[model samples]
Target: MTGTTLTTADLDPHRRRILFRAWHRGIREMDLILGQFADTELKTLEGEELAEFERVLGEDDNDLFKWVSGEKPLPEHLKTPLFERILAFRPEEAFKPVV
Candidate 1:
């Protein structure tokens, strides 16, 4: 899909904003990674997890992409379980061969 299928109608303000940001990250790679993660996980995230997600979203897309893709190691401060979740949350479309 070109964009999120998750509806924001029932989401809290925080989640709505976070979802939008996740989908609109500067890079399409990051957008797909984070946006798909948010689409599946945002509704279930509790307050702390939401906070962690927001914090992770604040990182530079270049560094976040490297960290997520394993091209570079996660910095000490970013080596949290949430980041691990992000590392594992690969949407099937992300791996599809480009045409």
Candidate 2:
């Protein structure tokens, strides 16, 4: 816990796991995608949405990326509104003009 601090200190165990996992999903793009999701929407997700997110996390990085990017058809079980929201999610810094 040496590097642990205020980031997830106040969160419950479940949220802490989700926050950590979202930011450390192996692939950097996936990390940023899910990490930003954790930062903004994770806290507000309903139980079913949270469950859907967990299912999304269970997917392989390449497949998830394809699904999120619409490069492949979404499997019926994975095509929830929450997944659609992930598809719509744009990182806050994405559209910023570099100085």
Q: Provide TM-scores for the models.
A: 0.89, 0.78
Superposed Cα deviation of residue 15, candidate 2 (Å): 0.6
After superposition, the stretches of candidate 2 with alpha carbons farther than 4 Å from their true spots are 1-6, 92-99
Q: Write the per-residue lDDT of candidate 1 for residues 1-99, one digit (tens) a residue.
A: 549989989998989999999999988888899999999999999978889999888999999888877899889988778878888887767656667
Candidate 2 per-residue lDDT over residues 1-99, each given as its tens digit: 212223776678887787787777766667777778777787787788888787788789888767766689989987678877887885654334457
RMSDs, each prediction? Answer: 1.7, 4.4
Question: Which candidate should be chosen as best, given lDDT against the real structure?
Answer: 1
lDDT of 1: 0.87
Model 2 TM-score, all chains together: 0.78
lDDT of each: 0.87, 0.73
